[model samples]
Target chain A: MAIDERMEGIEAVFLDLDGTIYLGGELIEGASEFLDRLDHRGVKRFFLSNNSSRSVSQYLRKLTRLGIPAREEEVLLSTHDLLNWLEAEGIDDTFLVGTQGMGEMLEARGIRTQSKSPQAVVLGYDTEITYQKLSDASMYLHAGVPLVASHPDLVCPSPVGGLPDVGAYLSLFETTTGVRPVKVCGKPNPSMILGMIGELGLDVECCAMIGDSIYTDMAMADASGVHGILVLSGEATAEDAATSNVRMSLIAPSVDSLCR
Target chain B: MAIDERMEGIEAVFLDLDGTIYLGGELIEGASEFLDRLDHRGVKRFFLSNNSSRSVSQYLRKLTRLGIPAREEEVLLSTHDLLNWLEAEGIDDTFLVGTQGMGEMLEARGIRTQSKSPQAVVLGYDTEITYQKLSDASMYLHAGVPLVASHPDLVCPSPVGGLPDVGAYLSLFETTTGVRPVKVCGKPNPSMILGMIGELGLDVECCAMIGDSIYTDMAMADASGVHGILVLSGEATAEDAATSNVRMSLIAPSVDSLCR
Candidate 1:
């Protein structure tokens, strides 16, 4: 399908949830209004996040609780993208250093989890990190298992300052094994964005990415050759956005200001 | 105190522990015999390890268990060195991202541990790393806290391969906080070797760095204009040692073969 120049002409709008639509459990002011405008325009909207801490179903439920109606299929989480990628590669047995959500995601794809001889090492936002787990992951990496990181964020902003996420584990693995990850499949990576665009069969030229973090959201736009709109309702300020390589085409205070 | 070239002229022998005496838990072959020979030679041997996971007392205990006669005062651990250095600098409050051993060592030196308003950041080999610890350290580093790393071994050799040590943490802090450590007070850092040489009242030319790891032990010798004797008892193999920039004066099977 041919893509149009304006955002209204686009078939899909992929949104970053945390720090973009909401902070913590509260929605950003005007986020619901922005969604209502999208609904009125009959444009498809998808909530995408790199956080593998929760499932897409959970994200959908959260959005509903915030008075924004979102279906299960409309939300794309990192775990969902990872499982889809793994299935496409025809992989079965793997070692996971992440949450139970990741384990469930892999199991749902009919992939067997093996600690001893895992074909690949999947890293996610794991809260239950033990020394044994770290040792096993390091061993797997040293044995030349393909390393895949869920995201590249070093820290995730919390209500209190910042928290170490998947990137912390990734750093440890890199240090111990002297091996950097081969692939990172998340919001910032173009492959994930292209996959999302492919589902809608939309032309890349007309799409616009809206999010709070310029590093990920705007970079995704630049990578996909699309326009990016950065909203200052979340993590990044306008000054922070200005310093990025990805030029912001539209500047809005929040998602609510986008419709006007 | 005029330092002489003869082995008998040496009063105190500063020895690197990791590669020279042992690799991980198991003692290097003939290492105990080498210590026995030192006793016969009337040389006061001090076991020095850049590893900050344990204290001097702990090292002494471990060495005593391994059949090497050692006292807590004769063991120089990195944390002990750091605490001494901090005290000399007149710094009382510090933020430490290390083990309980390191914390205890610093506390013994009267340096208060501050998570928020730390005057300096003392990094050590913390086996039990948490996201909160890394986050706090990064913040302190970003705030321009004077950074001092205990050592520079990116990976510590373990029974199960290698694990990320203090150097790895320094790297992570560098990447996240955009600040490189100003000082690394461990082997190969010049300052550490010089400090030990001064304590022994030995000239740099008369001193010899006898250890296993070429990067740390031999590199320290090369940098400080001292003799570097490589032992094949730890981390680096003979082949790996051959290609290093550090001059390998004597390639012995163990420290026992050093003065034979």
Candidate 2:
């Protein structure tokens, strides 16, 4: 099938939150209309996000607050994605260096969390960091624990300013222990996209990834052989899309243009 | 007096242990004869070592086993040197990353050991290391803690092979924390030698340094404007001394030859 024909046959759609479907607490104009069109067409849809600061249920609640109907199962978060990957990889326990939300998520997935002699070190967005915690994590790394990071971003921009992210911690550990992380399970990596595709049982070529971050969203599409749509509602501007290595299949001012 | 005249006047001498006196538990042949000659001259002498792996009492025991007479105050260890320097600098409390020997030495000198919110990081040769210790040190560095390293040897040779020394750890931490040590108080730097000179109340030109390692012992003499005697008893071979950057005032097969 031709690229556009494959896109036309897309049985499932994966949407990125924050910059794609909504910004802050407001949905982009016509996001509901686009979802309604997908519903009418009988397409399976889900929202996959790299943000680990919030849980899937929290995202669902936010969607509800924004008048977008989202089921609990249809929202896949990085924390959940990591848990799934760990379970599939036969990792039943991990030394977690993240927030309580991530700890809860890991425990919910039947993974035991321990500070001593852990099989792997899982890093998420942690705001409550301490010197003791950093030392304990470094000890685990020095003792040769496998490392898995949720995302590769060095900084995450918030309402106030940019804060140190997973990449910053990774750099510190790498410098001290001379060991870099073996794998990352979010964003620009195609493994997460492929997992989403498998979970949704979608035809790969027809699926489109629409988001504001070209590095992650478009890169994921390019790597997974899916159509990429760049939207100007969030992080990336039109100029960023033009200079980006991942070519966009379509450009829309907002989700409103998709249905029109 | 001229350096040559001072060299002629020297009757007794002090020597550094590791890298200077002997390496890896083996006595430098002719070292015993050198000491015997110094004894015959009724020269006041002692041995100084910066290695903190063992206590002064332990060093005395080791020296006794090796057929060298050692008294408590006669053997000036790195711990002693550091304590003296700390007292002279008026630093009562310091964050030290070293062994029990270092801790004992600091305590004996009335210097307090504080790891958290440390005023400065005083590094020594620590045999026992953990990731937590390194992480804590990094945190202190990030918080703008002044770094003071005991020595600058990248690796210290052991009976089995070589281990990363203080310099290696400093290199790794500097890469991550963007802070290098402010001062190194060991051989090849003039401060330690000059300090020793001040303690002995000897003129710089009148003092002579005799040791096996050309890079450290000879270079120290060169830097301090003192006469240096290179002995073939420890780390450096005769070939190394010939090609080394350190210029020597005298070459001796052993301390016995120096007396001749």
DockQ, every prediction: 0.30, 0.05
Deviation (Å) of A252 in candidate 2: 17
For model 1, report DockQ. 0.30
Docking class of 1: acceptable
Candidate 2 lDDT, B228-247, residue by residue in tens: 88777667788888788777
Worst 10 residues of 2 chain A by lDDT: A155-164
iRMSD for each candidate structure, in the order shown: 2.5, 8.3
**Per-candidate TM-score against the hidden true structure:** 0.86, 0.57
Candidate 1, position A159, lDDT: 58
Calculate model 1's interface RMSD in Å.
2.5
Off by over 4 Å in 2: A1-260, B1-8, B253-257
Candidate with top TM-score is 1
In terms of TM-score, how similar is model 1 to the real structure? Answer: 0.86
